[model samples]
Target: MGINDDASAGQAPHADALAAGNVLNALPPGYRLQEYSLDGVLGYGGFGITYLATDHNLKCNLAIKEYLPSDQAVRDGTFSLRPKSPGAAEIFHWGLSRFIEEARALATFNHPHIVRVLRFFESNNTAYMVMELIGGQPFGEWVKRKRPLSEADLLAVVRPILDGLAMIHASGFVHRDIKPGNIHMRTDTDPCLLDFGAARKLVSGKGGELTAIVTPGYAALEQYHSHGHQGPWTDLYSLAAVMYGVITGQRPIEAPARARNDPLPKAVAVGDRAIYSEVLLRAIDWGLAPAEEERPRSVQAFLQALPRADLMQPSSLPPATVRADSHSGFGTLDTALTTQLEAALARHLGPMASVLVRRHSKEHTTLGPLRAALANDIESETSRRTFLERTEGLLRGESPSRPPTTVPGSRAPVSRPPTAPPTTVPPMFDPQFLAAVEAELANHLGPLAAVLVRKSAAKARDRAELFLLLSDHIANTDQRRAFIRKSVAAFKDKG
Candidate 1:
């Protein structure tokens, strides 16, 4: 769990040590674990203790979660962990393996909204997982401070979480715990999903019959049973509960209780209409369904329930001062063009792409300027360039390539001259040639190949020049050389 500055709430550096029932249990400040030095306790729970640590090699602060399992194990005199009883040893070791598994699984994901696990290793007869230390407040604390948030403001936080959670589900894991406390609000106001201690992998799309590890209001009814059929919907239910708390300023009725009498009020009935849209409220209600089968099966279904317009209405909320320049001159966008631009931008920006495009589209009506404005939002020069190249056709309001005029002696096809306008010229390569090159490059660079091919094509005057330019994007020397050979051979076959 990431207990940020605001979440600690004025606790002394060693507060968590006391909270965990033993000061001696926590590694004292300046205790070294390889390159990291334990500074103090960040927070501790039944499963483990998180420490504020300094990475001597990196010269930065990070959080290290130690698999303490306070109920089964305790710190010995020599600062090493040992099981309390002979029977507890099996349970403690099993839990340690699961904790390490959690670290490995989370480390594979690089999503902005997921807490990053840097590394994990065993030390002092226990395992430790090093994680990026977030510098803001817990979602629960942040919500208290920024209460009365508008629909747009609330969705801004909710959307990123859904994005991260969707990734976790797609990868076959359920974050059994999705309470506000597990959601970290970064200094930049971005939300990150944290505390994967309760996360478990699903087998054949269903979670195994394990012990019920759940938060009261957030957990779905399925999570309340040891042999319950838990899946993605389980996480959605918890996420919806968090939203319910944000909207109603109170936690919804617990699942076990709801399953019996079902007295919990619908979000649509309780949420203030003036502050929140009916569609948004209804989505929350649907997500909070007592029965897992009754709730939205996946994140996509839940997202569809709350349409984009309902979530991005600027009029009902305060003006986005940071985006004031792009929020003016609101105009309607062509449906096809809008979808195309959103898909292209989504490749670079992930789930937040649509939100950004919608905000910018309100100002620019034309594709060229709209693309330029969106490109500026991309922080990376490489990504921005790739986005511009990928959408070059959209900028010109036409297909990326046209029919090629083949040269008589050379294999390389010459560009056809435009018949409609003297100033316009066809692309240097045909659509088939570009697609072939993109396909070949995809073997090395994945989806980024298409954008790189388009960028190289714009600069290359001939087939040889095009292959040479495309090779620059590939870092591996052998692979780059191999790509050039394959590309040239493919061009010959095409000719």
Candidate 2:
């Protein structure tokens, strides 16, 4: 949504949220300003203010961050490191270098563990970043909530953090401060990582400025050493300390001054077996090592050390890879509809289908049995969105994922189902609609297909089932009828 949506979406976001979506939408084109009033202030940095804002567009909670010169921006004249904000308008111009550079840099990163940037813009002397709002408290708060993670859970959290870090590291950036505050996790399972405010691109060995600043407790000894340049190993060291705090319930203040040459991880002893495992301890030790050179060289190396954990279907993760291959293969499109996608795609694409397979695979792969059996029924219907504006009544009755539908003017199904005799008579299949009638039919039932389909609506009321039957009947094809019939069959089976 534009800045206006950010601002005036009925209920206000957390006072800290960026004035709901109104502010975000109000922003001039190509300009954004997100304020962190969401969930109260998480924290602020030298670069900007981060707020947890409600995203009216996505209809999900979000952390909307606005980038303006930190207090430091006023003193410094440069744009990025040692950058200055000349004045109100000047902050925009002075901060332009960092605003654009950071936006460009953030765009390159996309991972489940890594916080995703939803959108970006700059205005009113502030640059804004719209980001995903994750559950669970930050690491420090997490420590207070759960005391410390169980060793297995600790491993779960650590591996993905390293994985995310590895991605950033692969991009040639070092998370200068890998502290507990920056390392966040989801409560249940499959905890991921967060925060990259201190991330720095390691280009031309200019990261020397990072030597001046480091995350306390977690920072590697080399990070504090002005003379010693650092690398990815520095982050590994800090992450280890975070591990120490999570399992041992005590943060490691510092590493041994003279780290030993035994570069690989060694077992760390924790008094409570209930809290930790030998393998996990070893992983921590390797990460907590003093020398950046001594820690695992890459995030991949650390992931290899951790247990073989599988990434589960995220509660909100979308299957980027979509298909419509059901039992009946895609045939010629209905004169009006395209066959590019069909209900069967869900079965064919399967659960194991990697939405990003083509993106990450070295060798082109085909859908497999394991994947096929485990299907992902990712529907691309947009009915509620389209109908929500014309008649919000439709939204209350069905799900957003359901397909589009229509009201028939007559009993007979035909390409042109005779126009409405009067305003009272409803029409059938508004081809102008963007949503699919089939998808909407299922959504209208709210997954309770068995009972709802039999209960017909008042003939006057427009509904998904009515439109679906009319469309299928009018198409005058068994295949068309089978589409809805199969859905009914699936629902019955589920019951």
Candidate 3:
């Protein structure tokens, strides 16, 4: 709360209130008009005006946003007075509800990367919220001055944006409108995501269709066209697009031009000057997919699918509590039934070709050409399957030892690693590793294949890619999220 002493209380109302038609200065008789001295009017949107103000109560400089009921439709050239539609009044009511929700939604933000709401009050036709004023320039401006930010700088700023989005999603909200203009960076280059969160909370609590949606460039197609189908993926899509713009100067579009077939829009090959790696470039492509069902299902899944080098580094996998043991009726089958069951699975999953490879070596050691090719594919597939199986076993292990890692002069047997230190160290992001893990996870967990493709795998937010990969193996949605919530809480606890 950046409220200065003189700004909070004991100040004369604006003398120009009458001239400006400041409907709020005479806010009800007993309730006085609060004057927060305006240092600068930052910007105005269709919804309301935002000003930089000094607050006395909080004794700090703050950004005060007064959300006035939007009369934007009249000015936007969309709605008309000619004829009332089936739900004209209903639409108006819904829009008003959304506006309120947006205000309340703003109030819910408590992250360091987000602007904090110090106080919220209603007067006349608007809602006034006092928030922390971040000293930063718009991302658009940063791009203008700094041009392509260094990869490290990109992460310093972008990571927090992902974090803020995840935080918003965990609270059951979506920042459907994600774009460069919506991102702000402090003078220090610490990026703060702004105006990215959606304002749908004021609508029906049970969730209803939105009449209007976010802007086109960064907005997910589903957000606008799909009726009442809003979910975490919508925001995931938009965020991926923002990342795309950050990495590649081009505004990422969803339509694929076909270097590779990805669900989201792939970053156009901008060559060396491109700010992101191929993994990130590919991740962006996945997130910008045209359809909701075609996108990653959750933010976590989106994180996992991101391209990252950390995927190759030995990292602690999420807790492995849910297991195949959860499936009941695991009695040992008769030997006859065991053979039949194995045969069935073999036919279904494509036989463990290693068995054939072994049999081949024994049966025809001298076989050439056709037999060699058959055995070669079988050997390769077998190796991949074996690696995937070992990983699955490691993931299911009950012990919390260190994850298996290839190290110099380490004689100990390869076993799953212990859980990471519970300190609040931020993650080391690697886009390439993220992509590889996603490819591996998709291979290991077949039934939950869609999880790998969740959100914008093809869009390239490495952290989102990691989460997507994790989501694929986890059993229960509630449980998977609970793990992430606990992890964040663990860090917050340390902090």
Candidate 4:
């Protein structure tokens, strides 16, 4: 019997309501597949359509993934699945069986972060994998709706995902595709790794053995070549790309283009290193290294390179190792030196000033470089003098007056009423003001700076409004004031 001409297809009287001319070729809502009723199309991709479904016997919601490779098949006016060309049938069935095998393999997994497959079956000349209908936002949309994830938040989300990847790797499979869209964030912020359609048996140096599918920006260069040695490092690159996207709000350039002429900037160089730990940024850069051997060989090693929990605690805690070589000309400093430097800088800059100072020390090992970097993040001349004096004292082995009790991004109790929003609207015609805003924003946010400045400028009614909107981008109070001071000067110079 032709797959589409099955008796089950004819019995679903209300199936047409859901399937009514949907281009994805998904069975309409109310269409029965075994004991489950399709509710609607939850999502569709190049390889399949995920349908929100109800298991009538169990009376529970599920997501059903129907394998329909778009390039090789089409649904005609009669809603029948057919190969685009007669010659494609042999290849189609081979892929169809592989899809079924993928479902079977995933059905054995029970990890929290890995999407669970309940069962697999054949229908409509294709395969379907039934999964629990997970409730959460995709990582792509999560990043859009929420604020940029700090290094701690990023690690919290990705660590569990790496745990899940470890299981898949142990099962002797490579999840060839891992990207923002394939990751879902639960309401409580736990992450689930989704999509295994690109997964293949862990085989190396074999051409045409694995499916040639990849998400461009997230795919490693090896995945591009059929004979490329695919291994754990393949997923490692994509996972790092996903984390890179979370912090920077943009994917690294595609691996192919990068192989030819890599214009990709190191994560530390992309933005203010203070906003994110140098360790986290460098780890991401290492994960995204073009060559597979250069990338982290294992998930555990990658996770180890990230900032630890202790680093995110109150500033009074012992200093966590911060790599200073790339960010500042100085090599890595011992924890004591770091603590002393932070303590001295905090004295002059503010409670949160240590973050900015530490970041400055990374990019500027010498006093001159340190002063230049600090000049952009510090505003008052007196404060600047105090900073210099404190540095001089620290260099001379003087003790820090007192350590900051609070972390840079931590909130303090609100004892006083919030300040009123500025009412005086400034003219919108100042180019210098906008340029200054972008420049300051780029210091922390990297390439996303221009995009954010434009977004803030659009909502701004006046110069005061613009300042208020952009100020939130800078996490450190000292840096915010410095940005405002410089931007205000731009308007004055124009006058």
- lDDT per prediction? 0.69, 0.45, 0.46, 0.64
Predicted structure 4: lDDT: 0.64
Model 2 ranges with Cα > 4 A deviation = 1-40, 54-61, 67-71, 75-99, 124-126, 143-148, 205-212, 225-228, 254-267, 270-275, 307-495
**Which is the leading candidate under TM-score?**
1
Q: How much does candidate 4 score in TM-score? A: 0.58
* lDDT digits (tens) for residues 303-359 of candidate 2: 444433322223322334534334323221131111111112222222111211211
Residue by residue across 79-195, what tens digits does model 4's lDDT show? 557788877777678788878887888898999988788899987778888887666666666666666556666777887898999889888888887877667777635888776
Instruction: Report the C-alpha displacement of residue 441, candidate 3, in angstroms.
Output: 1.0
- Tens digits of per-residue lDDT for model 3 on 1-495? 111111111111122112212332212212222756655454444444555566655566666565433443221232122113444445544554565666666686788776565666654434566666665566665665665555555555666777777787777677665666556667544667664224454234555566455555666665555374777777777676666666656565433322145443346365244445554555555666666676677766665545332232122222223222222222221223222222222221232222222222322322222133232332246643543343232223322123333332221212211111223433554555445544544643332334444443554233322343354334343444443333222211120
Give the lDDT of residue 47 in candidate 1: 63
> Which whole-number lDDT from 0 to 100 does residue 202 have in model 1?
73
Q: Which consecutive 10 residues in model 1 have the weakest lDDT in total?
A: 411-420
Q: Write the per-residue lDDT of candidate 1 for residues 1-495, one digit (tens) a residue.
A: 211222432112232323333543788878899999888877665667788888999898888888887778998888899999989898788777877887788789888998887888998888998888876667777777777877777777877888888899899888887777677777435988776766777766333665576666778888877688898899889889888988888888879899867999989899998788766787898899898888878876675455354235658555533222233232334656666665666555443344445545655666666777777766679978887777787645654232223332332211211111224343578888889889987776544566667877897655555665565555444565566546534563222
User: Which lDDT value does model 3 have at 388?
Assistant: 39
lDDT of 2: 0.45
User: Of the pair 1 and 4, which is ahead by lDDT?
Assistant: 1
TM-score for candidate 3, residues paired by index = 0.52
Report the candidate with higher TM-score, 1 versus 4: 1
How far out, in Å, is residue 42 in model 1? 1.6
How does each model score on TM-score? 0.62, 0.48, 0.52, 0.58
